[model samples]
Target: MTDTKAQTQAKSADAGHASAPKEHYDIVVAGGGYVGLSLALSIAQASDLKVLVVDPQPSERLRKDERASAIASAATKMLDRLGVWGEIGPASEPIRDMIVTDSKVSDPVRPIFLTFEGETAEGEPFAYMVPNGAMVGALSDAALKAGVDLIECDSVKDFAIEGGMTSVVLESGHSCTAKLLIAADGVRSRLRDLAGIPVVRMDYDQVGIVTTVEHERPHEGRAVEHFLPAGPFAILPLTGNRSSLVWNERTDDAKRMLDMDDFTFSLELERRFGKQLGELKELGPRKGFPLGMTLARRYIDPRFVLIGDAAHGIHPIAGQGLNLGFKDVAVLAEVLVDAARLGQDIGAFDVLERYQRWRRFDTVQMGITCDLLNRLFSNRSDILRHARDFGLGIVDRLPGLKRYFIEEAAGNRGDVPKLLRGDAL
Candidate 1:
């Protein structure tokens, strides 16, 4: 596999003898997005393995954007493990409480409501809100501090596995060999296709309109989720009086909404959001993305594995998408590092199988939950809506059930890795 023309030329440029190979790493990660960068940092910290992260975009460029953001408490622990929570924490907005309501705009009746107060045994928040660029920037810094090689402005041209080693050729005329190769390149991963993995896909017929806004009144670190017939409108707290909005609407309607001027858009937003935050001003241009789910046929191959969105994509209604990727990193890093400690082949099928077993069920369960929620809340049936509201009211009145849900949101409900629990890997 290393004898390919590009690999050979790259090797020759690094060494005097054509027969001798040069520049190798323990693991090569294709795609240096959030997932890949975090995985590289975790692996480098836990083992003596040399890690290489290959990404097409420069690190600096990825740190600026008005894009989709994520929720859930597990992501914070993962960032702490990567050693950047301190830098990121100051910029983040804590979600002190969450209020959920269900009702129609025309109705004057009391809406069925549910509320959760974020709590922790250690007096920390249940979750935080950070921009996409901020998290990636933090990961990039953490990876560099851990001595992981960051190869920016480059992409994997091709890859092959032979003799139990995976070889990759880069567009920068560089070749790297590693025992294991990971694909974290996201939903449209080319490496996943190259590995011949099939994906099961489903389109939600919805588009998420995302933007940041500045309100006249302070949010008091509260997040509000309103379930409308079309979809859910989530207002997540940002620093101070600012907040991030993820409004899921029908695809066709969202396109027209995006085309409207700022004044019209804000008015529509206010109608849905009500006077909770007073006057809302647009903080920047709005963006929208089609919503869908893609699940890879398999998570592992001979010497290759997939992580993050490369392995699975799900509806963002629950806001667990990126947090799920962090869980993937935690599991895979633990499995591989444990194998290395015991003198086991880190890339062996058994080692990779451990990661699959650890992650596959959790990932599938979250995907199914998100899919069901989107379907259940998007419909306008009066009977179904009444039943749903009744269920929410019951859960709201039951403190035990509410606490259980809160614990789950805080990422403390199940078996978790040490790093995910805010411990050293």
Candidate 2:
């Protein structure tokens, strides 16, 4: 016997319920770190797009991170436009000037090879050394306030592009769908691997020892980078009489130093840190991150894209890792927003390729530059050292070239995106 019309309608509803996702969004970003949250905040603020961010950790947990980054002027501009830089800026320390020194660990005096007035031509500091916790906290809170959905304590387990939308499965077995899927999971991105994206990577066999130190004298907003045979030992000024340290060393040497007693470690730190900051005392805990450069072979897939560390992870030699990620967020957000306005599919290959085209060269160029800098500086060859020092001296003597380098470090060079240029989308 044939079913009644009402019964057929009820069965159809049941089928729909079985196939429909628990939730749907215009974009679902995996890994709600700085890049993911910033992307969500940008898109949510600029348009009515529904955005969701999934991460394995809660916002509070993310804020407990002890790391600090050198936030470039261009990034701060974007953050200000997003309305969260106010919270972050107050907690940050501007780099009023920067000096680069090339010397050996045994060198009694580290002669400054290059000096830069950190402020851009507009009288803004080229960069700020901001605590990671403050930046993450501000971005996370702002993203939430901007109406972006957040899912913590779980992450995107896997995903598949289907019928113009990407279906996502979370580790908790929860499922959702979105027009576009983004992976900001990090350098060792699980989502990137799942998507079959290949990467070009270089392990420097060096580790960056990150920590903070309290100095007897104030840093006066000056940053110092001592290019030693081990690597670049950067003393980035923080608020008060403190400075953040990014010390690079050979893997074995870093292991030994990290295992040293407090007194012994202080001596080791001082040998390179010098007496300019007066006495130095270690602050909080020290973290060692392996140095490397990881660049995804491609930045886009069908309805999928990568941002931040998932797309490229460069050496901290130039302190531009986070800045590169910010560039990604800016370009991608602008591309997607413009496409949405033009009534084009935001996740279409061509539309996504626009972002890839705009960002790919910049990312690769920066990665190679960092790699070369690391190689040139992190070595024991006397000839190479002299050569690099001569180059640095030339850059120092040429004010125009030095200004260009400062602008490059500020991330205001090249084809600037609207968000990065501090303009609204």
Candidate 3:
């Protein structure tokens, strides 16, 4: 956090150098993943900025993807601004309520330690379970509608900055220029490395197994998080009779459990997932993602900026990972659009620093909170077990405190950007 824009750019200078220009745009975003795609779409909507999204996958693959994201309420508003949420919202499941429990997977009784009566506002629930396919399909359609160009099956091979422009070269043997370059690539970001950005990487020695389950009985828009000894097992409500499951376990245990035969895996899954939801069946394929935390030393360097996972990767203990990326999207888009409207150089460190300064505190706070929570609850120590549950019980009894926590989880905390507040940029 102490690193200044000048120092970071100076470091980047030794790393990457740009030459000449050919096809030009107002902005060239590297990596057309969710964060990159959302930012590009937002920028294209707010300004006459010619934007290009470079990636290695076509739109069809994105649409057919099975991954799902917990879209915090604030992020839903941001997506609404980009004109995609409306298309996906219908299929998204609103989290009308939530329950928290603490116990071992082998325990007979999983006592509910805390409960939240949902809906932060009228007709607005705390969050929604939006499938990645719906988001990808909506964003792709919206991006095309907004006249944003898509360079599929290709990525930024490298890029250089000269004068006031950043020239980007693709692996497809093409070069283009943009006033500003942003890296929404991912947590393991090559652009971040090329820009000489250092990140604090902390591996949790755990992995999250994600999949959906269909239950015979309805969830009634309810969600549950059971903090077992291994990790938090979440039953997040989705559209219809299905719910998304994020089951975390130690790295070694995860590998062994996943490799088990279907009958064994279902039994293990049922242990964490109770019969309260009637019978349960695993839907589709299950995937495991290694858990870790990564925070870039700096968010901006020269004309290049980092957002989404490229900026920070926190634990899913709190479902705020995607929301944090959307926060970055909202603030960066506002800064860039305002600068361009003022006829200022969007790539200037002076202009880019404003976005960094706006976001750094919030990002760091969330990352630290998640890391601490994962440690606090993902254990069986008698002291922490009793301490955290006592804390949760107190919060549950206090209406005001519970509302504050709900608002925070909804990403409505602190000074939020207009777009996230459901306002147009």
Weakest ten-residue segment in model 1 by summed lDDT: 12-21
Q: Candidates' lDDT values, in order?
A: 0.83, 0.90, 0.87
Worst 10 residues of 2 by lDDT: 12-21
lDDT of 2 by residue, 236-278 (tens): 9999999999999999999999999999999999998989879
TM-score, cand. 2: 0.94
lDDT of 3 at 251: 99
lDDT accuracy of residue 228 in candidate 3: 87
lDDT of 3 at 94: 93
Candidate 3 lDDT, tens digit per residue, 130-182?
98988987776667667677777788888888887898988878898888899
TM-score (all chains, Cα) for each model: 0.92, 0.94, 0.94
Candidate 1: count of backbone clashes, pairs at least 3 residues apart or interchain: 0
Which lDDT value does model 2 have at 408?
Answer: 94
The best candidate by lDDT is: 2
lDDT of 1: 0.83
What is the RMSD, in Å, between candidate 1 and the native fold over all Cα?
6.5
Clashing pairs in 3: 18-160, 18-161
Return the clash pairs for model 2, or none: none
lDDT of 1 by residue, 304-392 (tens): 99999999999888888888888898889989898999999888998999999888888888898999998988888899898988899
